[model samples]
Target: MDIDHPLALLGGLTPRRFMKRHWQKKPLLVRRAIEGFASPLARADLLALASKEGVESRAIVRDGERWRVKHGPFSARALPAASRRDWTLLVQGVDLHHPAAHDVLSRFRFVPDARLDDVMISWASDGGGVGPHFDSYDVFLLQAQGRRRWRIGRQRDLSLRDGVPLKILANFEPEEEYVLEPGDMLYLPPRWAHDGVAEGECQTWSIGFRAPARGELVRELLQRVADEAAEETSPLYRDPAQEAVESPAAIPPRLQAFARDAVAAALKDAPLLDRALGEALTEPKSNVWFESSRVPARLRGVLVDAKTRMMHDSRHVFVNGESWRASGRDASLMRRLADRRRLDARELAAASDAARALIRAWCEAGWLHETGESHG
Candidate 1:
């Protein structure tokens, strides 16, 4: 994806410009971001997905002054009739299970794969909603079916309602309103408050981006770096001259400083620290897994599903939590796969023998699939 290229999705601004100007800075509303957009999964299809054990889903219903939330795999009897109003079914990671949903997500290739999270589908009845809330991460909410009325604002009060299952805002202030039909999209930066109510039966696809907190990132990176440092060198405690103190309650200041300096020295290698950080950031979520299949010897072209998160930085290629050292033409080929997520027959032929072998391994692991195959 050319970040400099103008996009209808970014309101005619180049993705580069959009990222610099609006991403994480403010909200952006684009009409017909996806022209003629339709729900990739039918209502029944979504319900079937919700019935699966591993798929995350929730059913929300408004009953007068009260709201009810329930985990799903809900039977037909559990749901109100289609004509009934004020209920909703939300299915998370629709892109992971539906091919068309994944295809729709590929349009946002302007964002790096590491930051791009999953797409969630929300199907709501008339007057149904999850209520006013704010997300800690960026999101693109695309209306896929019927209509939804949205009230949005830059909220200052981050307080939540007490004793509620959902983290609803205690006080919501709406500065703008929009009734979105199919194909319209609203982009909200982190901490932007928004509420969407179904004007009627509707489905909305939310493409969410992950934003790791600073402390969480530091912890993960430190752990990864420590593991790498441990493998490289085994430093034993050196206390050549030891004296027993009359007061045995406290550690010696010299010993404390020595331990601190040792840790500091271990972390002093900037390049090693960066590599570990990259690896940790690209690690896949625990629940993610790929299907296994043998690669054809006469492989022609390969296609990576948009739901597959793959990334690379400098010395390593990271895919689904696994990291591999890459160099020469192999590194170039892998980088291309990371960028485009697909390779034609000619491109495959251009790869080195070692790179082809690596590709075969990825194919067997189900990271990459042979193009034109009937896996779907």
Candidate 2:
């Protein structure tokens, strides 16, 4: 993508301009972000998907001042009827299940894959809503069908209503309001409170970005590094010169020093930390699974699986929670595959013997498939 080129998706702002001006700083509403946009899944299809095992879904029903939340795999009978007012069904990670949803998600390639999360579909009946709430991460709410009235504000008081299953704001102060139609989109920064109520029946597609908390990121990276570093040979704690202390429960100074040194050694490997971070970023969600296949003899082109998460750093390529060392021409090829999500015959033909073998292995592991093959 050309960063300088304007996009209709970003309301005529170039990728660079959009990132600089509005990305995390403020809100931007784009009317007709996707011109003539039609929902990839019909109302019935989305409801059916919500009932399937391994798919994350939720139902929220609002009655007067009360709200009820339910987790799914909901049965067909479990969901409320289309005519039922004040009810909504949300299906998470729609991109992982449908090709059209994946294509819809691919348009946001201007954002780094590490920060890009999955698309979620929310379907609602008349007056349906999850109520006023703020997300911890950025979200692009694209109106897919019908109309929804949105009330938005930059919320400072993060207090929640008591006895509610949802994290709804106790005091929602709306600064701006709009009724979004099909193809319209609203981008909201993290911690911006927003409430949307369906005018009648409606569906909205939320393109959310990952925003890992400092402590959460540190915990994940440390665990990953420690798990790998434990396999390395290291000196055991020795206290040959230690004398008995009066306080038997007190930790030995020498032992504490040894513990610090051990941790320092684990963290000192910059490359290992980098690899761990890359692998963590590309790790698929818990419910994701792949179907294995052998590489075809007459491989022409390859497409990365929709469920596969592939990324690269200066030293390694990470795919589906796994990492491999990459360098020189092969590194370039892998990077291209990650960026474009597919490589044609001409690009594949340029790979060296080692690179070809790696690609074949990826195909056999179901991370990549022959271009014409049917896959999720």
Candidate 3:
């Protein structure tokens, strides 16, 4: 992707321009962002996915003055009829379940993978909606089927209605409105309030990005860094030759300094912090799992499993919560695999004996798959 070239997806704004002007600062509505965009997952396919366990899904219905939501594995028999109005089913992480969905997700590679969350599919009947609400993360709402009328505002109240299953705004202030047709898209920065109601029936794909809160990141990183530091040969707390005239309940100043030094020591290793961050970023969601694998006798081209998350930093590569120290040619190859998600004949043949063994180990762990006969 050319950083300077205009993208129809951004409504003629270059990616650089979009990031500079609109990202996290305002909303953008692009008509036909994906020209003639038909949804990769059909309604029936979405329904089937919703019925499977390990997939996150939900059904929302409006009943007169009340609204309700139900968690799924929704059976095919459980879904409301197509003719039915005022009901919707949402399936999260569609990218992990279907190949086409993953391809659609790949379109947003302009953004870093660590920040990109999964694509969610929303299917609704006429009058269906989850009510007006704000997301904590940025989102691209791409209209893929039928039509949806959206009313939006930069909400300030940010209060939710009482006793509702959804976190709907109690005071929705619609400052603008648009009816999104097939291929139209709306980008909303975090906390931009919006509501969408199906015109008749619709499917919308939400490309969401993860925004880790400062406190949340602190907690995750501290835990990982502290665990790593524990493996180091640090001396146990020692307060030798102490004067015992003070209160027993009060922690000593020496102890406090020791505790502080422990934290400082954990942070002292910047490379450890990098590895921890990469591992945390690539960690799979709680619902994700992989099948057991075994190494083949001969090696070939390979592909990373769709569900596997891989990322790298200056000194190390991370995948599915595991970190590896990588350098030299092997590091370059691993980074390429992380970026492109596959290795071809020439790339595979270039691997050293140790690198080939590591690749075989990953294949045996189900992180990668052999695609063809071995060339080496």
Candidate 4:
């Protein structure tokens, strides 16, 4: 994707310009961003997905002054009828299951895949909404089906309502209001307070980006680093001079320093840190798993399934929850797959034998597929 070229998806502004001018700085409302945009999955289809155990879904309903929240796989009978009002079904990672949803998400490829998260669909009845709140990550809310009225502002007080399942803003101040019709989209950066209430029965697709909190990221990376440290064949403990501590209950100063140094040394290798980060970032959600299958003996072009999430950063390639170090031509090919999500026959043919073998292994593991072939 050309970052400098203007795209209709980015409101006729080049991604480069948008990133420089507005990204994480303010909000942008683009009309007709996706011309003739249609809901990729129908209401029934979305509900069907919500019923699947592997899919992540949530149901929210406003009952007078109170809001009710529930996890799903909710049966259709559990949901209020299509005619019922003030309820919503939210399905996460729609791009992982629906082709059209994936295609819609691919338009934002100008952003790096590592930061890109999955698309989520929210189906709401008239007057339905989760309530006024803010997200910690950036999001592009595109109206896919009916209409939605949005009220937005830069919030100062991020207080939540007491005793509600959703983190609704306690003091919402609206600076601007818009009723988004089909093809209308709104981009919001982290902590920009916004509320969307369905004008009628509506479907909205939120293309969200991942922004891991600093503390959370450090915790996850440290855990990964510790795991790697445990696998090392080096010395575990070294105490050449064992002197009895004056305070029996107290930890010796040397031991405390040694423990800190050990942790620091384990994380001292930049390459290992990078690899761990890549692995952690690309780790799939708990329910995500590839379907195992056999790859044909004859090699062919490879097509990554839209349902699978693949990503790479500086030092490693990540697919599902698995990670691998990429080097040489194989690294290049893996990077290509990370970028394009597919490789043609010519590209595969040009791959080194080791790379081909790796692809074959991935195919067998169901992480990849041979183009133009049925899985079954």
Maximum-lDDT candidate: 2
Backbone clashes counted, model 4:
0
Q: lDDT per residue, candidate 3, 1-376, as tens digits? A: 5678899999999989999999999999999998989887788999999999999999998987599888999998887888899999999999888877787788877789999999999999999999999999999999999999999999999999999988999999999999999999999999999999999989999999999999999899999998887788888999886798558898889999999998897788888888889999999999998776766687668888878899999899898999989999999999999998889878988988898898888887777888852211
Deviation of model 2 at 337, angstroms: 0.5
**TM-score between candidate 2 and the true structure:** 0.98
Q: Evaluated with TM-score, which candidate comes out highest? A: 2
Error of 2 at 145 (Å): 0.7
* Model 2 superposed RMSD (Cα): 1.1
Candidate 2's residue-wise lDDT over 1-376, tens digit each? 7889999999999999999999889999999999999796888999889989999999999989999999999988998899999999999999999998888889998999999899999999999999999999999999999999999998988999999999999999999999999999999999999999999999999999999999999999999998897888877778899997899999988889999998898788899999999999998999998888977786799999999999998999999989999888889999999999999999999989889988988899889999988767
Give the C-alpha miss distance for residue 131 in model 4, angstroms: 1.2
lDDT tens string, model 1, 26-85? 989999888888886788998898888778889988876578899977777787777788
lDDT of 2: 0.93
What's the lDDT for candidate 1?
0.85
Candidate 3 ranges with C-alpha deviation above 4 Å: 372-376
- Candidate 3 lDDT: 0.89
Residue 147's lDDT within candidate 1 is: 98
- Error (Å) of candidate 4 at residue 192 is 1.1
Worst 10 residues of 2 by lDDT: 229-238
